[model samples]
Target: MAHITAGVATSHVPAIGAALDNGKAGEPYWQPVFAGYEASKRWIAEEKPDVVILVYNDHASAFSLELIPTFAIGCADEFQPADEGWGPRPVPVVKGHPALAWHLAEKLIQDDFDMTIVNRMDVDHGLTVPLSLLFGQPAEWPCQVIPLAVNVVQYPPPSGNRCYNLGKAIRRAVESFPEDLKVVVFGTGGMSHQLQGPRAGLINREFDNAFLDRLIDDPAGQAAVPHLDYVREAGSEGIELVMWLIMRGALDEKVTVAHRFYHVPASNTAVGHLVLENALG
Candidate 1:
């Protein structure tokens, strides 16, 4: 049966993608950020998961006020990158694993989690940037991707606890699948930094680091964190961290920290990344 081998948590800052695409990654300003992921790129290449369940928020590119599903799973064969006002990033199209995706949707819904099943949707930086950060500039992504979009752009986004529980359900679903496959669950977005309002450029390194520490050592405690705390301390967009709980919930109780990286001011946002494997793996 298929089993989850690891979980990754990252910040999907769009400017990081632009820097890579514009050939500025080697420039002094961006070198540190890119350097942090060097070990990650090497590690993922070695692990080589067959499928990745990428959890990210759609940044109004695929869905807006007109429609938002609290939790949506992409069951399509492929996903095109969105324009995001700059035309699609010059990246390869995203090939998806429809079979595994549909299985997750069915199992999650049956487990009492309401999920919107998407047959087609253009993926934006929220999804692609993480891919680039880990996989680099490959002509094509190394493995099949399954987009699991969570709605953090809107108010009343799912709680950390709910997302965490959803991750547990996903693990159960994956193990029951008949295929022998290695899967990695990616939780993307957040590490303090708001894009607008008085606190638009907010960056709380203390809070961000603390959150990461808790995420690795005490996930259930982190999952119980309330929304107001994230808004007040980490900034509004900081709520994106809740999505990380989902990735944590999918892993074993104890995990080996394969790699961890964090940096500040990537387009006025905090960039954080972690690679964790099942303790036994």
Candidate 2:
């Protein structure tokens, strides 16, 4: 089985990317955002994993209310850039791990999880922001990427438990693969901040901090938290916590915290980052 080298969680604040590339929004607050990812880049260079399974929620760019998939895996050879209001970030096209992705798709469906498999998909800032920050657009990406999109935009998205189950299935899929590879799973989006309506600007330090503590120590307890409570308390879009369950499930009961950082109110989003390393075999 391929070793899971690392896990990363980050908020995909668009302005952060813009600030780095064009000095467009390089506010005093945004400096920390870029500095926070410096270690991630260094770690990736040191570890140099072969595949990255990006767990991120789309912001109504590719998948929408017309067809809301609980969890969708990308099997495309290349993913295009989306026009995320500002524009594409001129990054290298995203590559897919077709052999592993397809095999995982088959096994997931057989295991009673219906995951949408897309041949064509365009990723938005939610996924790209972290990519650009962690691994800038070289002639090519540092590694092949398996884009995993979770639904956090539309109402009544997948439940927390369901996401946890999906993560378990993903672990099985990775373990079942025939070839040797190094895999890193990333769960992106939210420490807490709402972007729509009056409920926007809501920040829950208590809930967010409690979540970080529970995520490493008591995953099931964290996974069992009501998704609605996340919406009502953490902010509507803050329900993106479900994606983290996927990353958490891939990990063993015990993991060493490599690093962690947190900040608030970055363009109506709470920005945070964490790296988890599973117990050594």
Candidate 3:
């Protein structure tokens, strides 16, 4: 049976993607952010998961006020990058694992989690940036990707507890699959930085670090964190961190911290990444 081997969580900052695409990653300001992921790139290359369930929010590129699915699973054969006013980043198209994706959608929905099944949708930086950060400039992504687009952009986004429980359900679903495959869950977005309003450039390092500590050591505690706390303490955008709980929930309750990286002021946003492997006997 298929099983989840690990979980990865990272911030999907758009500027980071732009820096890589525009050949600015080597600049002094961007070097540290890119450097932090060097070990991650190497580590993922070695683990080589067969399928990745990438959890990210659609930044109004694929869905706007007109429509928003709280949780949408892409079951298509491929996903094209969206033109976020910059004409789609010069990145390879995203190939999807329809079989596994459909399985997840079916099982998750049956598990009482309402999920929107998407046959087609253009993926935005929220999805691609994380891919670039970990996989680098590969002509094609190394493995099949299953886009699990969460709705963190709208009001009343799913609670952290809900996301975490969904992750648990995903693990159960994967374990039930007949194929002998390795799977990884990626939770992308957030490290406490608001894009607008009074706290336009907020970066609560203290809160961010504390959250990470709880995430690694006490995920259930982190999951219980109320939505208002994320908004008031981490900033509105910081709510994206809830997505990370889903990735955490997919893994063993006890996991080995394979790699952890955190940095500040990457495009006025905090960039955080974590690689967690299920503890082996």
Clashes within 3 Å, all models in order: 0, 0, 0
Per-residue CA lDDT of model 2 for 1-281, tens digit only, reads: 76576677777877776776676544677776667777877877887889989999888789777889878999988888788777777777888889988988999999998889999999988788878877865777888888899888877778887887777788888988988999888888887878779877888888887888888888888888898789877898778887888888877778888877777767777777878887772
How well does model 1 score by local distance difference test? 0.94
Q: Which residue pairs in model 1 clash with each other?
A: none
- Of the two candidates 1 and 2, the one with more favorable lDDT, higher being better, is 1
Q: How many clashing pairs does model 1 include?
A: 0
In model 2, how large is the Cα lDDT of residue 190? 80
When summed lDDT is taken over every stretch of 10 residues in candidate 3, the lowest stretch is 272-281
**Cα lDDT for residue 16, model 3?**
96
Question: lDDT for every model?
Answer: 0.94, 0.81, 0.94
lDDT of candidate 1 over 59-156, digit per residue (tens): 98889999999999999999999999979999999999999999998999999999999999999999999999999999999999999999988899
| Per-residue lDDT of model 3, residues 1-281, tens digit only | 99999999999999999999999999999999999999999999999999999999999988899998999999999999999997999999999999998989889999999999999899999999999999999999999999998999889899999999999999999998999889999999999989899989999999998988888999999999999999999999999999999999999888899999999879999989999999851
- The weakest ten consecutive residues by lDDT in model 2 span 18-27
Selected candidate, larger TM-score, 2 vs 3: 3
lDDT at 74 for candidate 1? Answer: 96
Give lDDT for model 2: 0.81
lDDT of 2 at 169: 80
